[model samples]
Target chain A: MNIYQYDKSKEWFQRAVKVIPCGVYGHFSPAPYAPVEAYPFFSDKAEGARFWDVDGNEFIDYMCAYGPMVLGYHHPEVEAAFQKQISISDANTVASPRMVELAEFLCEMIPVADWAFFARNGADVTNMAVMVARAATGRDKIIAIKGGYHGTSPWMQAPGHHGTIADDHDHLFRIPWNDLEALDRILAEHGSQIAAFMASPFHHPIFEDNALPADGYWQQVVDKMHENGSVVIVDDVRAGFRLHMGGSNEHYGFKPDMIAFSKAIANGHALSALVGTDDLKVDAAKVFHTGSFWYCAGSFAAALACLNILKAEDGPARMRMLGEKLTGGLRDLASSHGYTMIVSGEPALPYLRLADDETLMLQQAWCGECTRRGAFFTSHHNWFLSTAHTEDDIEKTLQIADEAFKAVKKQFGS
Target chain B: MIDQLKSRLNLKAVLRNLEVLPALDPVSAELISDWNISLRFSVWRDTQVVLDFHDGRCVFHSDSKESTSVNLFFSSPAHLNNMFENQASPLPLKGFTKLGFLKKEFSQLIGRLEYFLKPAAETVQDEAFKKVNLALSLNTAVFAIPELMKLDPVSRRIAPQFSAGSLQFSVDPDGPHAHIIFDGQSRAVAFPGPAVNPTAMTVFKNSEVAQALVAGTLDSFAAVATADIQLRGMIPLIDHSNVILDRLPLYLQ
Candidate 1:
C-alpha cells in the first residue's frame, strides 16, 4: 500500500499558523500527533465516519471530531431537526419551546436528572456544576480524580499547565482514581470544606491505559461523599451517550447528583447540559450561569432528535458491538505480527497500546502508519466508535491496521 | 520561593554550563587550560556548588567543597542570584588571593557564556556559532527543570505526577543530547548526553529547528505539528517538562 502525502495540508497549516494560534489549538492541535508528517493538518470535508483532508487523503475517522460526531457526521435526523428549527428561529430575544422540550426530554431520559441547564460547550456546564455544588453546600473546596478531565477551566487544568497560577488550584485536591484509601482519607479530613467530588465515570487519562471503576468503587464513593455532605458530580461529557442512554452512571449501577453531558449530545451541534437532582435545582438557578448562545433553539432541537434516535436504536450497545469487533480484530492482527496490543476502558471508547514497547514508540509509529493508510488512529487518546461504523468499515480498518502493524514490525523488528 | 528557585537555577543550571563551555568555545578553554584550582560558591548554609578547573576542562561538583580552592560566600540565595545577574558582587571569604583569576579570567568566561546564551541577531548568522549557542541554551534549559521542580510551586506540584522514567531530549542524528530521569516521585536528576533506554524522547529534526526552539523563535506546538520535532514514548514526561521549559525565559532572561 502506498502512503499518503500532505503537501496541501502543509500549505494550509503554514497559512493557519500565521493567522491561528498553533494552526489548530486544543485537542485538535498536532502536539499529540507525533511523526506528524503521517497525519493531515487540515480537512476538506467530512461525512459519516470519514473525512477527506485538504491533501485529498480520505480517512476512516475514529475520533468523531473528538466525540461530537456520534450518530455520524451530517447525521440526517439531527441535521433535519437543526434545519427545521433554524428555518423558524434559532437565536432570538426569547427562549424557544424546543429548549423546554429538550430539558423535559432529558429529565425523563436520565435517571438522576430532575432539571436540565443548557450551555455552549462541555466546559461551560462543568464550570456551572462546580458553582451549583458550591452554592448548595457553601463549601470552598473540590476533590477530583488526578487525571480525569472535566474541561479546560483553570481550576480543572493540571497544576503546571501554562497560563495557570498555583493559586488557581488552591481549593482543588486530586486523588488517584479508585484509590479508596486516599478518597476515604480526604473525605474524612476535608470533607466539610469540599463542596463536590467530581470525576468521569471511568478513568480515561491520555497517554496511559484507560481504567474502569473497580467493582463497587463508584457506589462506595457516592455513599462516602453523601455521608460527608459533599455533592457527587459525574463529568460524563466524553462517555455520556456512548455508555448508556440515561447516563454512564446508570451503566455503572451508581448515580451522581449531577451529570454534565456534551460531545454526542447534539451530534456535532454546539450544545452542552448539566442535569441535576431536584435538591440542587434552586442552587443551580441561583448560581447565575449563562452563556450568550445558551438559549439557541437549533441545538436543542438537534439534541432532542439525536437522543430520540439513539435511545430507540440503542446507540451505545451498537457502538460497543462495533468497538468490540474492531478491537478484537486489531488485537489478533497485532498478535499475528508478534506484538501484544493492550485494549482498555469500555469497549465503546477503547484505548489501545502496544505492550511490546512500553515507550509507545512502536504504537505511535503504528498509529501514524494506519493514518497514512486511510484509517485515522491516534496513539494517545481513546478511540470513539459511532453508530455510522459498519462491519465493512471495521474490516477495512483491520486491514489497514494489519498493514500498520507490519510497517511497525518492518521498522522496529519483532 | 522565586529568589530561592532563581538562585538554585543560577548556580546549578547556569553556572553548571561552564563545565561544558570549554568544549564549545576555544578561547574560554584556553584561558582555563593552565589553571588548576577549584572555586566554591556558597549561600550561608543553604546550598553550595564547586567548580574545578584542570587540564583545559571545567567540571562541576555538588558534593565536596574541600581541597585547594577559593571560597566565595553570599549572605543569602538572593545575594548569589544578584551576583549572577551582575547586580551585586560575591564576598571573597578565601578567594582574595586568587582575585585576579576570578575578576578577569572567570569574568571573561562568563561573558562568553552570556554571549552565546543571549546572542546578537547578526552573530547567529554564522552556522557554526549558531550550533554552539543552541547547544549551550538547550543544556541550560534542560538542567534548569530539576531545579525549578524543587522550588517552584507549580513545578513542585507537577513533578510528583511524572511516572518513573527517563526522558531524552536531543537533536536528530548528531547534536547535543540530555536526559532527565524521574523516580516517579518529585525527584529528578538531569545529565548531559543520551540515556540508556529512555522511556520518552523528543528529537528535533535538525540543528536549525533546535536553534529556533532554544532561541524562542519557533512555536514548539507548531514545530511538533509540522514534524520538525518528533516525540515518542510516555508523552506526559515531555508534557510536564515543557511546562518547566516554558518558565526558563522568565528566569534566564
Candidate 2:
C-alpha cells in the first residue's frame, strides 16, 4: 500500500496558518490524533460515507463532519429540497411558511414538542433554552451536569473562557453526570434558585466513552426538579432524531419541558430546533432571539425532507442495528487481538473506550493506522454512524480495522 | 467558532499563569467564587495552558485540553494585557458602576490586573489612558492568526454561523482610531490603523463605553443600546459584536 502523503494538505495548512489562528484548532485539528505527515489535511469533496481530500485520497467517513451528516454527505433528498427552496427565496425578513411546516412536523413527531423555535446551531437552541427556563421560573440559577456540552453561550462555557465574562457563568450550578446523590445535594441546597436542569440525552464528551443515564436516574431528577418548580431542558444536539422518531427523552422514557435539536436534523444542513411544552411557550416567546440568517428556508426545506425520510425509513431502528453490528464487531476484533473495548452511549451515537489504557497511546496508534488505511474515525472523540453507511461499508471498515489492529500490535507490541 | 474545534489549542500559557501564578484581585475572586472558570491560553505556537478557577483558587492542569465551559481563551500575551489595561484605566471606570454585576468590586480586579501588567511605570501620572495604551501596546501589537483551515470541516462549520464580511469594534475617541476586526474566520485582528470602510463597526462614543464593555460591566446588548455608543454597518453585526469585543480581555497564551 502507498504511504499517506500530505503535500497538498501541508501547503493549504501553511496558507491557513497565515490567516487562521491556532491553525485548524479545536476538534478539527488532526495533528493531535493522526500523524501530521500521514493524515489528509484538507477534504476536496464529500458524498455518502466517502470524502476526497486535497491529495485525492478517499476514506469512509466516520467523523460524519463532527455529527451533522446523518443521512450522509450531500444526501440527494435533502439537497434536492434545499436546492428547490433556494431557487425560490432562501431567507426573508418575514420567515417563510417552511418554518411553520417544520414546527408542526416536530410537534407531531416529538412527544415533548408542543411548539418549537428555530435557530442556526445547537448553541443558540441551548442558550435560548436556558433563557426560556429562567424566564418561566423567574429563577437566576441553573443546574447542569458536569462536563456536558450544552453549546457555546457564555453561561455554558467555563470562567475566563475567551469571549465571555463573569455574568456568563454565575448562574450555573454543575453536578456530576448520572450522580443521583450529587443531584439531590445540589437540589436540596439551591433548588429554589435553580431555573432549569440541562443535559444531553446521553454522555458524549470527547475525552472518554459516552455513557447513558443510570437506571431510574432521569425520572428521579425530573420529579425532583418539577417538585421544586424548575424547568427541565434536554439537549438533543448529537442525538437529535438519531435515537428515536420522537425526542431522545421519549426513547429514555422520560420527558423535558424544553428540548434542543441540531446535528442531523436537516441531514448536515445547519439548523437547530428548540421545542418545548405548552406551559413554557409563553416565556419562550418573550425572549429576544433572532439571527440574520436564522430563517433560511433552504435549511428548513432540507429538515422537512430529512424528517420524512427518517419516518419512512425508520432511520433510528436501522441506525440501532448498524450501531449494534459495528459495536459487536469491534468488540470481537479487540478481544481476538488480546485487547478490550467498551462501547457506550445510545445505539446510534456510541463512544469507543479501550479497556485499561490510561494514556490512550494504544488507542491513538491504532486509530492513526486506521486513518492511514483510509478510514475516518478519532481515538479521542466518539464516532458517529449515519444511515448512509451500508452493511458493506461496515464490513470493509472491519477489514480495515483488522489490519490497523495488526499495525498497532507491530508498533506497540500489545 | 465553538464547533470548529479540530486539533490545535494554544491554552497552555494562560493555564500556567492562572495556576502557578498571579495574585488575583479580591473582587475577581468573589465574582468567580461560586463559579468555575476555565481558561486556555496559547502562549507560543502550539504551546498552551489549561486553567480551572474554582472557589477563588486556580488549578493548572497537566495538558492544554479543551473544556466546554471555557469562558475565556487568550491566543497570546498581548491580547490578555490589552484587555486588563483597558479595564484598568479610570476613564472607563465610570461605566463599570452602571453595571449590576460589575458594580461589586469587579473594578478592583481589573485594576489589579492593570497594575500587574503595567506596574505604575516607575512614576505615577494623572493621564490614565496614556499609561494603559502605552503599557498594553508596548511589547507587541498583534500576532497573525495561525491559518490552518478556512474551508475545512470544522472551519466550514463555524464560518457560516457568522456573517461573510468583517466585523470591527471602533474604540478610539482620539486620533489613530483603534479597532478589532473579525475576519469572518478564526482571526480577530486588533488594528491601530484607520477604521476605513469597515463592513460593520461599533464605535465607542468615548472611553467609558469601551472600558465598561471590556470590564464586563455593560451587558453586551446594552452596550450597543447605550447613548455613548454609535453603531455602523449592519444592525445584526452590532448584535453579534460580543463575538469579537468580549474576547479583548483574554490573553490567549
Candidate 3:
C-alpha cells in the first residue's frame, strides 16, 4: 500500500511533527527510520495483500508491519471481528472479560500454557516475565543469546549496545547464538547465580549460521537449567502459532517453563500474552504486571478470530506449504545466479541472506529497492507470508524476488 | 549537586560545575543573539547559568569570579543543535570533592533534582532525558540473558525463573564489540543490528539443545528435555539495562 502521498497521513504527519515528541510510539515507526521524503509514502488504508497511500498509490505489502499482519492488513475475518467488538463497545477498563476470554483461548491452543497474562505489546510481556522470574527465584540475574532481538526495553539493550548502558545497570549478560560448548561451560560455573535464560528458537531467518539446531539441543539445555535450579523462558512471540496449532514447542518436543507470544496471535490487534506451565505459573504470579489499555476488547476479539481461523480448515498447513514454495523458489533463484544465499527458519518466518559480511548494507539496499517496486517488506528482515498472500500472490512475490535477487547480485558482485 | 550535599553532610571540599541553559528562548537561530540564562532554566544553587550574548555556546555563571581566567571547555555548537533536535540534554552536572571527582554524589543530586522538578511539565522532558542518561551511565549495566530477554514484558512474565545468586555475567566493552561472560565462558558476541535497531539471538546449552536448534529443527529449543548447560550468576541489576543503552548517545553528544 502506498503511504507516501496520502493527504490525510501527510497532514497528520505534518501536524504531528509540530506537537508530538517523536510523532510515533517506540522505535518501529520512528522518524529517522521513516524519513518523509526519501522513504516510502505513509499508508492510508490496507486490505488483503494490498494497501493504499493518501497519494492513491497501491503496493503489495511484505513488511507486514515488521511481522504483525500475519493475516495481512484488514483481513476480512479479523477486521469483521474488530468491527463487531467496536459496535459492542470498546472496553478500556482495568481488566476486561475479553482479556480473560483471549487468555482462555490461548491456554487451549498452546500445550504448555496453563496460565496466560495479557499485554499490549511483546516488550510489556517480557518486562513482566523478568519481574516474575526475579520474584519467584528471588534472584536478579538473567541469561540470553547475543543478537536476539527481544524488544526495545532497557534490560534487553544492556547486553546489546556496548557503550549505551548506564553505569548502574551492568547485570545483563550477552552470549553467542547456537554455541553448546560455551553454554555448558558457563552455566556449570554460574548456574547457582542465574535467574533465568530467555531465548527465541528462530532469531531472524538463520538460526545459527543459516542452519537449525544439531540434535537434542532443547532437552539438554532444559535439563541443565533444571539441574542448576534456573528457569528457561522461551520467547516465541514471533514463532508461536505460526509453526503449529499448539505452538512451536510441540514441534521441538520440549517445553519451556514460560512462553511469550504476540504478533500473529492477535492478527494485527494490539494484544500479546505470556503463558506458563502450572509450576511456572506460580513464578509468573510473583511479579507486578500492569498496563492501562491492555484489556481492549477490539484486540481480544481479533485474537479470538485469529486463533479460530488458525485451527480451522488446515490453515497452518496451507500457510506452511505456501511459505515453503516461496522460499524454495527464492533459494533456486539465488543458486542459479551463482550467489550463495541462505534461507533459514520455518516457512512462516522464512528469511533469506546473501552469504557475505556486508549483508546488512546489501539487505538495506534491497529493502529500499523493494519499496520502489511496490512491496512494503524489507530484505533486511524476512518474508512473512500471510493467508492473504494467495497462489497468485506467491507467484508475484517470486517474480519480485527474482528481479530483486538479480539486482542484488549485480550490486554486491556475487 | 551531590558533592555539595556531601559537604552538607560534613564531607570534605566540594566543587560543582552546573551548566544551565536559558529558559525563555524558542531554541532557534533568531534567539541566539539575546539568549541569556539569568533565570528559569539557568538557576543552580547560588549560581545563575547564562549564555554569552555573542555566541550561543559561550556559557556564563554568576559564581564564576574568574570567568576570563577559568578555561572552561565549551560544548561544540553542533552538539547543542543535536540536543534540541535529538532530544538530548547536554547540560553538565559534575560535583567534585577535594579527593577527586565525586561523580556518584553528583548523580544522586541530579536524580533528586529531577524528581523535584518532574511536576513542571515543560521542564520535565529535558530533565527526564538528562537523568535517564546520567543514572544509566552511573549505576546500570546488565549482563544476563534472562534480563536481556526480559526486555520483552510479555515474555518476561512467562520466562523461566532463576535465582540471581545462580547466574553470573562478565561483560567487557573494551573493543569494537562487547564480550559477555556467562556459564563461566566468555565469547565475543557481535552487537545485534545497530545501536538502536532491534535484534535477537538464541544460544544452545548443549549438544542436544544445539541439535534441536540446528538444520530444520522446527521444535522449541527447550522442548525435548535433555541434559544441557546450566545458568548462573548475573551481575549488577536488571532494571538498569536502559541506563547502559541510553547513556551511550550521551557521551557521543
Q: Find the candidate with the highest DockQ and give its number.
A: 1
Write the residue-wise lDDT of candidate 2 on B168-223 in tens digits. 45555652244445554544434443555555555666665655654457543323
**lDDT assessment of candidate 1:** 0.90
What is the TM-score (0 to 1) of chain A in model 2? 0.97
lDDT tens per residue, model 1, A1-414: 769999998888888998998788888888788677889978969999999999888999999988998998999989999999999999999999999999999999999999999998999999999999999999999999988899998999888788888899999999999998999898788877989999999999999999999999999999998988999999999999999999999999999999999999999999999999999999998988787889999999999999999999999999999999999999999999999999999888999999988888889999999999999999999999999999999999999998888788889998
C-alpha lDDT (0 to 100) for residue A63 of candidate 2: 81
Q: What is the C-alpha interface RMSD of model 3?
A: 19.5
Q: Model 3: per-residue lDDT, tens digit, A112-160?
A: 8899998988888877777777777777778787657678777775333
Q: Score the docking of each candidate (DockQ).
A: 0.73, 0.02, 0.02
Query: Between the candidate structures 1 and 2, which one is better when assessed by DockQ?
Result: 1
Residue A43 lDDT (model 3): 68
Per-residue CA lDDT of candidate 3, range B1-253, in tens? Answer: 3222222111000111122211212232233444332211222232222323335432433334433221222144333333324344444433112112113332343343333323255654463344332322221222223232333332232232211222112111211111222221221111111222212111224333433332225233112111121211121221123223333222221
lDDT of 1 at A406: 79
Candidate 1 C-alpha error for residue A70, in Å: 1.5
Sort by TM-score, best first.
1, 2, 3
Predicted model with the maximum TM-score: 1
